[model samples]
Target: MTVRPTDRLDETVGIDTSRPHPARMYDWYLGGKDNYPVDAEMGRQMLALDPRVPVMARVNRAFAHRATRWLTEHGVRQFLDIGTGIPTEPNLHQVAQAVAPDARVVYCDNDPVVPARAAALLRGTPQGATEYLLADVREPDVIIEGARQVLDLTRPVALSLVALLHLVPDEDGAHELVDGLLSQLPTGSYLMMTHATADFTPEESTAAVERLTAAGSTVALRSRTGFARFFAGLDLVEPGVAVVDRWHPELGEPVPGRDDGTIPGYGAVGRKP
Candidate 1:
């Protein structure tokens, strides 16, 4: 059953479609129809900054898929996927449920568009349970609380924050927010994430960030070192913290255009113990 967020929460929600939202822009990149003209205009500007933008998006999604597969295959049955963009096909739940039919997934995102079409994300295998929570990463308590309704926090759960933290600046305490959430999970839990960075192409990255910021979608591109801090104290998996496209390429098929050139993003998976 698709539970409307407005029904889940007592407060009335408002969606402002006049401005470009990151989730909608990402949908535009993935060739989804849930975006408006504002999203396309901003997406085009990003393309002008770097034509590989779409390729990078595909690579990021590939990494998330591979990581989810890896975790499920390794005995992780519960998932808390924050920053889940639009309802793209083969969503996190679908990938995990394919590997382990009983896998349970909780998808979270602040975007109003996501909740509107969240029914697509909730459809999973008969043996598994899938739920969507209309919440933001910044409010860890709200997310964690909502997730407990569908997930077991006492057991090991893979926390997926792929391609999310870049939109959250340091002033917002991105690091603190991650640590705060992980602090509540069991020792065997994991954190899987990918973040955009300025390390590869400084000039283009800076300009892109400026445009995104001006359009109300702030991008705080991190360096390699900054990205590593998110995993502080956790044991990073083998071949730790490599570039998004380069991490465990043998684990999955190569994205068509991902190898053409460098994609400015960092990806890593860490175990709580």
Candidate 2:
């Protein structure tokens, strides 16, 4: 059943054009036209340091797609994707429902601009459902409640935090927030994540984080061990917490430039036992 879009908030959340937002900046990196000049400027700065910034974005996006397909093929029919950025084609629901036509998806993002383009998010198969929630990942309670409206909490759901948690610093209770949200899911539910890491290119990654922080954007590129802690209680899928591109590359197309330089991120999927 197609879900009729609902207006949850009465006021339109204003988009801040002065500073760079991760979503818009990411869009800029992906060569999408939905970003502002300010976002492009920051994206340019990121590219200057690592010319493969766009490749990294694509690699991260590809992982999200493959993970969704993997989960749906494994019998999952509901998804809760938080930290979902601007609507990109072949979105989580589109990928999941392509395999499981009756899949239900709820996408949440803190960016105010996301809601304005939420229509792109709602366009899923007629047999499937997609809904966007204007909420922050930091507030897991609010996100869970919003997701509950469309997804059955008793059934297994794949929670995707792809290419997003790195934008949230540990000081913001990032780990705790993930745990809180996962606690709401039933056993057999899965945690699919891709986190940027400084493990490979420490100098460049550190400098990138500093530059983003100066512009009011934060990037917390965690170490391999730090990223794994996010799935402590869960059983990790095979190829435990490898580099983003290295994890299940056989499952998806190889990202160009992925091997030429360091991808600078880790990706993994874990199941709640």
Candidate 3:
């Protein structure tokens, strides 16, 4: 069965189309029509600085798909995907449930636009369950509490933070928030994540951060070491902390233009022992 957001969610947390949202900007990058003019404007600026922005987005998404498949094949039956953006084809639930029909998934995102199109995220196999929570990652307790409605807190759950933490700067206790969520899961649970980094092109990355900050969005691109810090205390899977597309390329198709230049992102899956 599918669990949905409350009807009052949209009214209470109104979509602020006046400013550009990261999720909408991401959608625009993916060639989706869910973004506004402001989002497109910022996206264009990002493209101008690095035309690989769209390719990076696709590479990040592909990482999520491949990571999901790997987790399911390895016996994971539950997933808690935070920072889920606009519903695109073959969402986390689709990939997981396809591999294991009984897989259960709980997707959480702060974007108001997500709740509007969350139904697209909730569709899953009859043997599985899919749910959406209209909440922010900053409030780990809220996300955990909501997820409890659908997932078993006592069991192992894959905590997915794809393209998310970069938006959460240090002042927000990004690392602390991640630890808080992982602390609630079982020992065998996993942390599957992808973070955009400035390790490859510091100058361009710094400029991109400035543009997003000016537009009311936060972008804290981490270095390779900083990106790996999120997985501290966990055992990283093989080919650990690799460039986005380099991680398990055998599991999915390559993103076009991936080899054209550096993707400037890190992706990995780590198991909590």
Candidate 4:
């Protein structure tokens, strides 16, 4: 199904291209042309800190693909993907609908660029539905309300938060925001997440965070314990909380250089109740 564009181009105003945006930086890291020079410059700085930055991005994307396939196989037909970055290929709906063509997905992100390029994300199997919501993860009510238009909230919806929470700092009530989103999901709903962390290389992680923060982007690299806190009351899947690349590597092709060293991130899937 082709999801119609709900946002106008004028809504893309207020984009501060002088500074780097996470979504654009991610696009740059993935070798996409959607990012501007500022984003590429900041991405280069991040790579200087950790040369494996691009590899980590691929690993995280692979995890999202594997987790979505697993969820669809396990009977999840609805998905709410928050922090939807610049429309990368094989998006959440593409992965889920591949396994279950009838899957329904709602992609949400605070970045205006996403909505502007959302047409790439909206193409789904005719049996399924895909919609994009221009909202922030902190605004749980807004996300929920928008998601309901496409996904049946009472059904099992896999909330995909891959590579997002780390961008939200503690001062912003990150944990509270996650709890709020989970509270609205049904008992059988799932949370599929991949978060950047400082546990593997504190010095490099710290420097990267400092650079990003200085560039006007929030970087709250968490510890393994802190990442696990987001799934507190949920049931973790097997091989729980593995490094992003290590989580079900059999489910997808390995990201090049993933085995060279730790990826400095954690990924897991958890079911509510």
lDDT of 1 at 192: 98
lDDT of each candidate versus the true structure = 0.88, 0.86, 0.90, 0.87
Top of the candidates by lDDT: 3
Q: At residue 60, what lDDT does model 4 achieve? A: 88
- Candidate 3 stretches greater than 4 Å from native: 6-11
lDDT of 1 by residue, 152-248 (tens): 8999999999999999999999999999999989999999999999998999998998898888887889999999999999999978999998888
> Going through the candidates in order, what is the number of backbone clashes in each?
0, 0, 0, 0
The estimated TM-scores of all candidates read: 0.96, 0.96, 0.97, 0.96
lDDT of 3 at 69: 99
TM-score of 3: 0.97
Which residue runs of candidate 1 sit more than 4 Å off their true CA positions?
Answer: 1-6, 9-11
**lDDT value, residue 215 of candidate 2:** 93
Distance (Å) between predicted and true CA of 127, model 1? 1.1
Reference-based TM-score, model 4: 0.96
Better model by lDDT, 1 or 2?
A: 1
Question: Residue-wise lDDT of candidate 3 within 6-107, one digit each (tens)?
Answer: 443547667789889888989999999889999999999999999989999999999999999999999999999999999888799899988999999988
Give each prediction's root-mean-square deviation over alpha carbons.
Answer: 1.7, 1.3, 1.3, 1.5
